[model samples]
Target: MCTYITEPVDLEGSAKGARGWQRIERAHVSFDHPQHAPLDHALEIDLIDGSGARVAVELSAASARALIGAMERSLERGEAETGEGAA
Candidate 1:
């Protein structure tokens, strides 16, 4: 069953697409039929830049949760190393 729910939001980050790495300005998250993922349905995320650059990722629900947690840890470590999280 397709969820057909798309949640889009503005974001700041960098994603590597076909051309190269580009700044991400917006992101669209949805759980629906995937084009390439080897599953009936997957959580799809589309990262888009203001300049029209785009990057897409499709992962299983469990994989998506793991990715989110890993990303949070990675960012926290980077901020800690740079003392950016210090008051």
Candidate 2:
């Protein structure tokens, strides 16, 4: 079953695609059937840039959750070191 659940977020970063590093402008996050992942459904993340360059990722639900946790932890440590508040 396709969930058709997607969320678009504006981003300011760079992603390495086939062509090389591109300035990422936005990201589309969805939970649906993956194009290549070996699972019935996976978390899909498509990072896109202004010039239409893109970096795509598909992760299992458990992997996605772990990634999220790692990101949060890294951000927390970074913020503490920089004396910055969470954004």
lDDT per residue, candidate 2, 1-87, as tens digits?
Answer: 989999999999999989889999999999999999999999999999997667999999999999999999999999999999856
- Per-model TM values vs. the true structure: 0.83, 0.92
At residue 58, candidate 1 shows an lDDT of 97
Question: In candidate 1, where is summed lDDT lowest over 10 consecutive residues?
Answer: 78-87
Best by TM-score: 2
**In candidate 2, which residue pairs get closer than 3 Å at backbone N, Cα or C atoms, i.e. clash?**
none
Report RMSD (Å) for each prediction in the order shown. 2.3, 1.2
lDDT of 1 at 44: 96
Query: Which residue ranges in model 2 land beyond 4 Å of their true spot?
Result: none
CA shift of 14, model 2, Å: 0.4
Model 1 lDDT per residue over 1-87, tens place: 878889999998799888888999999999999999998989999999997667999999999999999999998999989878734
Candidate 1: regions farther than 4 A off: 51-53
Whole-model lDDT per candidate: 0.91, 0.94
